[model samples]
Target: MKQFGAKIQSFFNSRLGFFVLAIALFWGKTYWAYQTKFNLGVAGSMQDFLLALNPIPTTLLLFGIALYMNGRKSYITMLIIDAITTTWLFANILYYREFSDFLTFTLIKGSGAVSNNLSKGILGILNPTDFLVFADVILLILLLSFKVIRMDIRPIKKRFAIGVSLLAALLFGANLSMAYSDRSGLLTRTFDNNYIVKYLGLNAYTVVDGVKTAKNSAVKANAKASDINSVLSYLNKNRTTPSVTYSGVAKGKNVFVIHLESLQQFIIDFKWDGQEVTPNLNKLYHDQNTLSFDNFYNQVGQGKTADAEMMLENSLFGLPEGSAMVTDGTSNTFQAVPAILDEQGYTTAAFHGDVPSFWNRDNTYKSWGYDYYFSKEYFSSGKNYDVGYGLKDKIFLKDSAKYIEQLPQPFYAKLITVTNHYPYTLDKANTSIKQTDTGDDTVDGYVQTAKYLDQAIGELMTWLKTSGLDKNSMLVLYGDHYGISGNHKKAVAKLLGEKTFNDFDNAQFQKVPFMIHMPGLKGGINHTYGGEIDVMPTLLNLLGVKNTGTVQFGSDLLAPNRNQTVAFRNGDFVTPTYTKVGSRYYMTQTGKEIEKLTAAQKEAVNQATNRVTTELSLSDKVITGDLLRFYKPSWFKPVDKKDYSYKLSNGLKQLKEAQEKKKTSVLMKNDGKSLADEYKTDAPELKTSEAESASSSESAAADESSSSSSRSSSSSAAK
Candidate 1:
């Protein structure tokens, strides 16, 4: 036993042994992360074997560089490399916990905008097991410090070190070849980041993403005005004329886009333990005055909510790699909804209870031509009022009424809620509904937060009615993205009462709630298959705006001949008749896999597949090449980002000045009285001094209302 122990120590003290140890530790840690942290969907023995073996080539390639150095330096260099790589792994782990996707260079470059908002979220999603990623680094450092693994100062031969690196290269080549064999067009036709990481390892995946990003940048640099011709031709060919019945139905009305954070379609009418998960939303969805879509999926990429926003506003798909809003938002030209509405003599503003920099909205909203932005600084925020992503939903919606009322009439406003975001955590006092017993905290708490959001929405709706804004405004409410990701399939399966969950189920799970509500409008649940990309065109049609000759990928949903194919970001697509997930096709009606497709089915799938590919590719080209810079429509005016400023004082002053001079605001029209008093909530956080202050403010406003009315009457008489 003594002799064996001495031999083991001696071997570890050698240069060769140390290199091998580092490779083994890195490979093991990466494999563990793959199996535990990521939902790579590794099925079959071949995939399992490839996933385990894929880490080796990259590990060898990275650690092999240390072989060229002399003993102690080589050991230190290998440890440093290990620490860096482990940190990268740890970052992805944290990112994947929320996004369910890998990191890209674009996201890294744009991190500065969102980093401040992520601190609390990062701490919330962290697991004790995540620390194990650094276990190898800690072990190596401790061993070196204790002198348990003595350093050999001998220099390795140059030829031998070169040979080691060459061996790593050869192994990587083999790995790539095998990966290609298993999955054809693995790199060129890459669909999901998961496939890249699953087949080529995370390190290799990062390299691929970096390469693609660089390629995209190069493409943009070389792009010309004529490059938009093809995109224009495609859109024109597929453009669907707006329905006469629905077009101009809500024209000249105020537009209020309510962005529901992380609310999925399943929760719309979902019942848990005899309790409706979203009773308020369900009521609105089924209301005769609301047009709801039952088959609206959120097609977001790694950018998630930001991606959804990009699609919703621009009628453009997000980049397949990262969030275009973060990566290209500052520089890219957009004919976004806000800009369009602004051109139509409407004041455009956005309200959010989070930091201006979160999702890079502060910069992106400007590019979108929003005249004013009311962000976290505009709201009352503190520990009690703020939760996961920003201010509690109830508080955010209640406070937003002040600003919403201040906006000029016939305005376009987007209110982004944040309390129902991921890591769905709500204090016990705020949680009025029962949570699901899914044995997963994320899944269980998701219900609670979603219910809270619904309640908040209900309060906001009531305020809108009492304030009389509902009569003139058209409300567009949509779930931003999926709240419970596929990572919690077990809990989801339990909650859904499914014996088993499959990829088809996951594809179907991406459906989100989309509704348009207005008074005395033709409305019902419309079974149109659409996505966020369709929002801009659909809304524009209803506003009596013609999208002809514009470069939009989506057609109006109200168009009788509108294409029903809903393309997901990852190359998968769903339609009314068929749903394709990865390499498999399933019948949309039955959710059964189609192993033996008939000739008609095959043709249908092929046509849909081509359309999906074309749309995604064209959208990518438009964004990556900034094609909008070249394609200016006669009716559309390019937005000068300089015209926008989201500073709290400046925004409030501008709104106030506009109201005083023009009396164009809803509040000004209502006799210079604020309608914030009409908003009520059962929020526990507001049940104290905050509530009292609100009451006092309401009373003060009431007491001064008669005087304000007299002043208004005198001004009107003078005019």
Candidate 2:
């Protein structure tokens, strides 16, 4: 036993042995993360084998670089390489825990905005097993420091080191060949990030992402004004006219968009434990003044919430690989909803409980021509008030009422909620619903957060009505994306009482609630098949805003003869007759896979597939090329991003100035009085003292109303 131990130690002390050890450690950590930490959906033995084998080439290539050096430097380089890769792996683990997706180059580049208030969340996401990601690094450092693995100072021929790198390249080629055989169009058609990581490992996935990002940047730089011509032609051909019945229905009305984070449509009236999960949303969805769509889907890519927002604002699809908001938002010109409304004499503002940099909204909102932005810096915060991604939904809505009241009348306001985001966690005091018995913490906690969001929405509705804002406002509430990912299929199946779940079910699970509520407006459930891309057009049509000559990819959903094909960010699409999940086709009504397609079904699928491909390609061209910079609409003026400032003091000053000028605002219309006291919430974190203070302030304002009016009159006269 002693002789064998000595032999092992001697081999590890050799140069080649050290290189092999580094590869093995990196390979082991990556596979471990794949199996346990990430939900890559490794199904068959082929995928399992690929997952194990995929790491070898990348590991060899990385550690092989160290072989070029001689002596202790080689050993140190190998260790440093190992440490860096391990750090990246650990970072992805933390990111995947929240986003249910892998990190992209775009996300990393934009990390500065998201890093604020991230430490507390990171601590919560950490698992004891996560330490294993760095276990090999620590072990290796200790071994080298203790001289257990002595460095070999032998000089190797330069040819030998070059051969090692060449061999790595050859192995990577073979790996790619095998991956293509298993999953056709793996690189060309990257429908999901998990596919890349699953087949080529994390290192290769990063390479692919980096290459794609570079190509996109190059494409944007070399793009021409004529590049928008093809896109304009496509839009002109596919554009649908607005419905005469619904057009001008909400003209000149204030627009209030409520972004419901991670709230899926399945929970609209879903009963769990014999209780309604979203009672308030269900009621509002069924209200006579609400136009709700049951067939609405979210077409987000890696960008998720930001993608949905992009679609809602510009009627465009997000990039296939990363968030356009993060990558192109600052530089790209957009004919967004805010700017479109701003041209029509409407004040545009966005209220988010998160930091301005999150999703790059700080720069993106300015690019979109928002006159005011109320971010986390503008909101009051405490331990109880903040949770998950940002401020609690109830607290966010409750605090936003003050700003909402100060916004000019007929304003375009967007309030983005963040409590129901992924890794949905809520304090027991805030939860009013029972958790599900699915045994998946993520799925179980989803209902509680969703319920809390519903309560917040209910409170906002009550306050809007009490302040008479509801009388002249169009309230649009929409779920941003899916709460539970396809990874939790079994838990979702159990929750839905389904006997079995498959790809068809997973595709169907993408549905999210979209409702537009306006008092005395003709409203009912519209079964038009559409996605987030259609939101801007639909709303603009209803508001009597003409989108003629605009470069929008989506048609008005209320149009009588509008095509009802909904294209996902991925190449997959859903139509009224057919649903495509990957290469397979399924009947939309029956959810049965078509083993042998009929002649009619084949044609339908082919046409829909072609359209989806063409639309996605054109949209990608528009974004990656920043084509909007050239295609200036006659009715629109491009936003000068420098004109906007989201600072709290600046926004407050603007509001104050507007009030002094007697510009119409909710508060100004109410005789220079705030309606903050009208807002009511059952959130446990809201202290009674706070409520009393608000009431006291309202009372004091009432007492000084005459003097305040005189002072306002004097100020207006002076101005």
Candidate 3:
């Protein structure tokens, strides 16, 4: 036993052995980061295994050069290198917690506000076990301090050090080549950021991301205003005017936009266990006052839900990569819907049940000219109020009634729901619907949460009607993006009773719900092929608000001569006849590729492809170069962000002042009282959770007691 101990001690004391130990430490730290920080699935798959092993060659090549230095210089160099690498990994872990994405040079360049915005709670990202990453350095320091090991003065041979580095380099090259061969077009194709990190290591992903950012920056710097001529010409020639019959139908009405997160069109009337999955949405879909679209596709880019927002508000495409709101949105100029409505005597505010800074929205909303922005801080943050993403859908809608009732008349407001987000999970106490046992947990959970969202929407509509706001309000509801990705296709296939899921099925799944409910209007399902980009023009036209001088990329969907070709950020397109994904063209009706095409058919496909490519390139340049700053519309003025505040404490006072000044607020017309008193709900959370139920009971008792006191005072005065 003593002999074995001595041999282990000797191995640790040796210079070559310590070098090997350092390599292991570096590699181990990287693997730890992969397991903890990223959500890249199992380690059993060959692709994932290769990614786990990727940190080795880079670490070896980096540390191999340190061997050329003699004695303490060599030892200190390795320690410094290890510190830098460890710091990089630690920083990425913190960033991934908020963004769920790796860092880019663009993000790093604008990281000035990151530190100040970071709350101490972000440190929760670090686990106690993470400290083991520094164990090697601590162990080395202790042994050297006790004089248990002495440094070797001899230098490693230069030829040996160089040879080690060269071998490592060759291995890294082969690793990259194998990754590319395994995932076809791995380095070039438009894919999810997660795929890049899963196929290649985070280090390699960062390097690739850096290269792409640089390339985009270079393209923007070299672009000119004249490059927009073709884009402007195309838009002007194809511009769609509002239909004479529908124009001014909902003029001067308050607008309420309900953003349904991750909802798809299929859920509109989908049945589960012989019951309607979304009964509330089913009623609205069939209602005579609602104009719903069955063929509305979500043309979002990498920003997903935020991309949908960008298109709906500004008729602008999101960036080809990261969210425009996070990347270039803060600095770019936009002729957004809120600002346009502001010119027409409308008060605009946005409500979200999450922190303002999560997606850099606190900064971007100001640029969009919102008069007030209410985030999660304004809502109830008490027990049982929040779910995974933010506030529970029921609690969020209930709490928002307080502020929504106070907004000045003719307000343009938006409510963003989050309970139906990805990896959907609902507390049993909150959920009343029966869950499916579909083997796939996500798809099963998706149905329950989606049903919950429908219930919340029903409660909101009831509030609107009882509060008397429904008579003069236009309600717009839209699904932000797809709920399930291709990863869950098999489960979705079983749910839909399909034989097999294919690319066509995936493409069809991209359809998102878009509905507009206007009181006393002729409404029915419209089968036009439109997207989120067309929303702005359609709403503005219906409200009798003209955006005559704006540079919008989409035509009004309600127009008599609307353009129906929808272009995706990836250069794919969908028209009434054909769907183009990459180089292949398929019939939209049949989803089959055409082996042969007539001359007219080929010409039509070529024209659509050219239009899509040109539009995407122009949009990219507009965002990256901040070119909109140069194009000032004659009727538009740049928003002064300094005028708005998101602070919740002063909310009541702000609402009162606006009402007193205008004398046009609906709350004032209803005798200086809030409309939330009329809101009725039987949500399970409100009934089952003690905290929520107590709060609701207390509010009701207070209102009743106040009414009783008022009657007694009036009777005594009469006597």
Candidate 4:
């Protein structure tokens, strides 16, 4: 016993022990992302404990580099410098995820939802102290493990300290070169101020400014007249609060929101086995009021899908303009859609197939005015996971509907589906898995998920009818974004059965799927080039609910005079507008009034870009666990809570109300409000989600090859 104690003490005294401990501490964080197929509730288990026993492989892989370091005359000093730098990076991302700190003052100018807004939000909230503590723990453990010890550095000469500083500077420059990082002009300024100018000999000022100027010039190149008109009009209309509000007759009607993962329109265009991948969707194209918009696009620049949905639902845009879901922690969303419903005495709830906090969604949903959040944990299912992370969509839908249908008189629900989540492969032979993927079973899993989605819809509809609420539901479904970025070119070619080729990913990247299922309403089709942001305004317009949330970034799709236009940014460059006609552009920024575009285009591009960037930046804040104050006073729907502070004094009103309410509804005739003769006086025939009235889906027998034939048949049958 005495010998063991001595051994342990000796280990702690050795320098080698502390090095191992530090490495282990940093690596421990890998377990936070506990997702793997065929595993249930086994997070941070064997892997966390066992990884250290077999560090041989990692050590061998880096042995060459370490050996090279040994050849240097200043190997010990260089090692210390490199170690500290690595530790810094680890602490920045792992401990804080940069949730509270903004990087550059200049880049913060734009109110965009993308291009750079999200990136800024991400870098802002980092906690250096947490990581440093973790580092300290590591050092403490290393000190206990007596391996080959290098000791006594504080007593070294002053010249040695300077040499170490120079080495650190060299390593930092190398890191900058190898990191492949990009920054916005404003953020770049901050980076220069903090790291580049002080540490690197280069004038970070010139470099950052050059980047910003270059970006501005590149954007100027991607402009159009319609774009210019839209932006300038927005600016003219007041950059602050909106002057106009929408009102309609959607009272007493049940609202249903379904979020389809990775849904896109290009599914209808992309060929699959010699035909369209989404033949059913395409065939339904002309069945409704198709707008065939000349221009409409998604403004989210990065973190694509999350950015897409956050901006749409919150009436906010994405980063560069603001922050992203995981980076920004200062978003203001409590004044969005749910708040509108809450004013009308409607019950509000949100659902997701994954952990509620994965993207900081748990906190953000409340700001949108939801009364309850249903994440995987709350669902509390006993079924085993065939694939990791959450329940299958079919099950979630069937189950969630049961819970939602029981809400008070009126309700607003956000259902975010996840069966179609990425990592596209699943463990074989897992009977519990609804959307299982085997190595050779790609199509089967996806197809099964589609069928599962249909089943989920069917189940939800059944609940509505059985619950005696069939005629009072209004439903809307939209894609979060395209499925995870993969080998799109290869997938497209495979779907089309085309010859193998290099470089060609079709417009399928921009497409997914969307639908609005408004029960008790007349059935028709809508074809407007609308993004998610337009959904709320469009809904409010239909419901006779006034719009309190309008920021020149989006307009009510039903508004007749509204221009359906959108812009996208690709790697620092603004992409041309993506319209129903397809992607095309021929514009310049100098205000030249060519028949195609003019100076107005420049203004529009900047405004739109700025809006998106701001949204992105803000979204990050929500995802990182901070709530910004929302002051939109225009939200006066009947169901909304006039004061959110009832919780501070009342202690837990929202939670109590949620538990007490059985169900709720909002509608025109039900609320005794008069229906508007037209949602938009100018667009008397405007299509809306209220037109979605059916229950069961007919997606089953639909096939790509028979798309055209089916459409023609359906048309003839109807005629």
Instruction: For each candidate in the order shown, give its overall lDDT on alpha carbons.
Output: 0.86, 0.86, 0.78, 0.44
How many steric clashes between backbone atoms does each model show?
Answer: 0, 0, 0, 112
Model 4 C-alpha lDDT versus the unseen true structure: 0.44
Model 3: per-residue Cα lDDT over 625-687, one tens digit each: 767666766788777654555555445567778888987776778887777767777765655
Q: Evaluate residue 387 in candidate 4 and report its C-alpha lDDT on the 0 to 100 scale.
A: 42
Decreasing TM-score order of the candidates: 3, 2, 1, 4
Clashing pairs in 1: none
RMSD (CA, Å), each prediction: 13.4, 12.6, 9.1, 17.2
Candidate 4 structure quality by residue, lDDT tens digits, 1-719: 99998786666443333334343543343222112101213334333332222222222222213223322223343345335534533433332222211122222332232223234444554445434434544454354345444442223344544454455455545434522232223242232122222222112323554574455434433433344343334434633322133235456566777776655454444442343444444443333422222123344545555566566665555554323543332133344677667777777777776655445454345446566766655453543442454666655665565356445657777787776655444333222235322233443355334433444555555555555555666666566665534344554445446565232133324544555545434434444555655666666665666554343245676565554444343312223342111223323222122245357765665565565454444333333322323222344432222232211212235544554543232222234231221112111111211232121123333454378788899999999
Q: Compose the digit string of candidate 2's lDDT tens values, residues 1-719.
A: 99999988899988988788878887888888899998776778888889999999988889988889998889889889988888889888886665455666655554342253235467877889988999899988888899988889998788988888999899999989989999887876554567888899999999987897787668887999989999888888888988889888999999999999999989999887778988989999999999999999999988889899999999989988778886677667899999999888899999988756567677688889999989878888765777846788888999999988888777999999999987888888887888999999999998988888888898999999899888999999999999899999999999999988899988889999999999898889999899999999999999999878988889898899889889998899998888999999998989989999989989999999999999999998899898998987678888887576566666799888876675688888888788898798887777755777799999998979978899999999999
Top model number, TM-score: 3
Worst 10 residues of 3 by lDDT: 111-120
- Candidate 4: where is the Cα deviation over 4 Å? 1-247, 266-299, 320-323, 329-334, 382-389, 426-448, 484-487, 493-509, 569-719
Q: Candidate 4: lDDT of 351?
A: 77
Q: Report how far off residue 700 is in candidate 2 (Å).
A: 22
List pairs with backbone clashes in candidate 3: none
Candidates 2 and 3, the one with greater TM-score: 3
Question: Residue 436: error of model 4 in Å?
Answer: 16
